[model samples]
Target: MFALNRKNSTFNFKKADFPKLYDLLSKVDWSEMTNVKEVNAACDFFYNTLECIFEACVPKTSISKISRRSYPVWFDSTIINCLKHKARVLKKFRMYQCQRHLDEFKKLRSQAKFLIAKGYSEYVKSMEDTISHDPRKFWTFIQTKRGKSRIPGTIFVNGEAISDPCIIVNNFADYFKSVYTVSLDNNYSANMTTNNNILLPKISEDDILRQLREL
Candidate 1:
């Protein structure tokens, strides 16, 4: 029911079908990720099958150090790249930082109050008020000026610039019969696999698994 991936759906690879594509990926034997892989495989299949699905390729979390180092080439590549340049409807990307950044983010809020009021400003905000006064002290090794690749400069949310960028995505795909949700709100809202339904997309849990089984 949640229409999140509906544009830029096709791929130009030799084997574009998800089932076939997954078979090729199975050769890699990625360790201890059977369950995760199953999900990814099913999702891949859904993307391939859904001719109307629109999705974007984005950078994986920096936490996945091995994958980042190993597959530098695959960073921005997706199962389906939008060669057609379809209009992408993305919920503005966000990042949730440590508590130390809250005051700074608040300062930024004051600084950006006028801009924050605008729809086009895309202001970043902190998730909490409780943290150490020294924002940089919170992040031990990752420093603002130590030449980190991803984070270019400090952008205050509330008043602090979070150490990293994370985001929430919504798109519609046609072949997906059931719904799965991704949250675009408070970082501390709840664990991703929560018991409640409202924060997530509308879909029966059984239907969700059934769609997975399809892959």
Candidate 2:
């Protein structure tokens, strides 16, 4: 879990703070700290008190889950604002069916739809162009959109709930191994030989080698 403690972790200083800081420092009795026979205790108290004062002045901080892909590249703030205005207009129109309000809402709704479609088309075009120049980025964008947001806490294998990480990995390994493992005595290699009786033309190995060299 991510934690943010604004009071202690951050100092949002403003011009107004200079006066407050000065006053705070002035109110502290430096002589009393000096009178403490032990140097470490006096230093600790002085610094701790100063820290507390600073924390008292700063604004409270708020923390939330880190947003993943909060907004797509083609999202237009102008269009969003227009939509919001249209929603308000719609509510007013519904309350009192004035032709002016109804017409305005209809026009705004059509405009929003058109702009949204245009944005989507442009976004797709940009992605296609990016795929040609940088395939890694194109795939990354797709993965971020399609990727699972949460990992399964437990996996069910053979009608049993399995939660151990190592067990889960081993189960997948065993499954894939069984699926791909070839039979040693299947005579699969014999089928790869070319049949001379076939009517189709067969290019010689030398011809293929010569073509590769030409490239």
Candidate 3:
């Protein structure tokens, strides 16, 4: 099992007073920035002022999330509550070595296991039933089971195996450049010049109104 930790930040825009922010911005003395002689100083003042205004209007919040790879996808409220109950039973059994507590723990453990298996089987059956109509979903489930894909350590270029990352990237860039490069010839250039020389017909307001009426 692996755990991945990430931090996400978002602004509370729903609670923000955008009208007040606009009024505040409109009242700001932007001429204060003009007093700064250096371009960097002026930019710093401008950014700082706006940052203070935004901080007051729309506060930001940071949340930390931890994801576990061992967590099952078929987990639901019923399964979760059963598992929690089983854990509590096991804890009571451990604290008090009573035969009744031990038996209860064992029973709950078996029930939890059964519920997990049943949930997993039902999820698989649903996927199987929808496979013909939604193959993409089936394939996505397959991919999740297979886990993340890794880039190849070596690549073939011009019938030669290359292991250097820089060389492989350069080869890809060169190949794409060749594929997308446009070739210019005398004939193409002459055609472009002739097309540029062709004049478009002029249309008056009356003609535009007539076309709109027809539409």
Candidate 4:
């Protein structure tokens, strides 16, 4: 694999960079670039100059690997604070054996639960209106709310257990293919309509026609 040759150049926009950026942009002469090539060069120059000015004005930090914890979408600062308060209450209750601390913890816990449930309900309700117009988006929203699926790490294939991702994927693909595929035999296909006594649900054609006409 070819390693990236590009340097990691990252800068955060600060209030101090505003005047420098404005000054850099104000010096541009757009009228001089008459041809496409000149225009392209001018555009590149403007972008590069802007970047230089931004780099000079703002402090750049070296990219470092950082560990982050992923939380649910409904988890905001309010929920975090609520959880922290509950934890503190629990700790105090345990330390002092105080009934009030326990009661406070229970109250906070109930409030947090209600808030989480309400958040999820609102989240789901928000998608209801989109179901008719954008079903794909609606289902995507539902799946996101449901979070990740917990498929078993190991699956049986041809009487043997397999856990490798590629093998499991291929096994599932093969199973689905076999289940959905229709096998055809020339003799049976040629005499397809010969079976006169096939069980099918009886329905009134006139009723169907009436419904269609109404539609």
Best by TM-score: 4
For model 2, the local distance difference test gives: 0.70
| Root-mean-square deviation of every model | 28.0, 11.1, 18.1, 12.2
- Tens-place lDDT per residue, model 4, 47-141, is 66566676667766567745265656656777767877898999999999999999999999999998878877776666565555566756577
Query: For each candidate, what is the lDDT?
Result: 0.37, 0.70, 0.76, 0.70
Q: Please say which candidate is ahead in TM-score: 1 or 3.
A: 3
Alpha-carbon shift of residue 88 in model 1 (angstroms): 24
lDDT tens digits by residue: candidate 1, 83-134: 1111121111114444544555454445443432431222111201111243
Which one wins on lDDT?
A: 3
**Between prediction 2 and prediction 3, which has the larger lDDT?**
3
Indicate the residue-level lDDT of 23 in model 3.
84
**Quality of model 3 by C-alpha lDDT:** 0.76
* Ordering by TM-score: 4, 2, 3, 1
Ranking by lDDT: 3, 2, 4, 1
Per-residue alpha-carbon lDDT of candidate 3 for residues 144-170, written as tens digits (9 for 90 to 100): 666642334688877899988778778
- Give the runs in model 3 whose Cα sits over 4 Å from its true position: 1-11, 21-70, 148-215
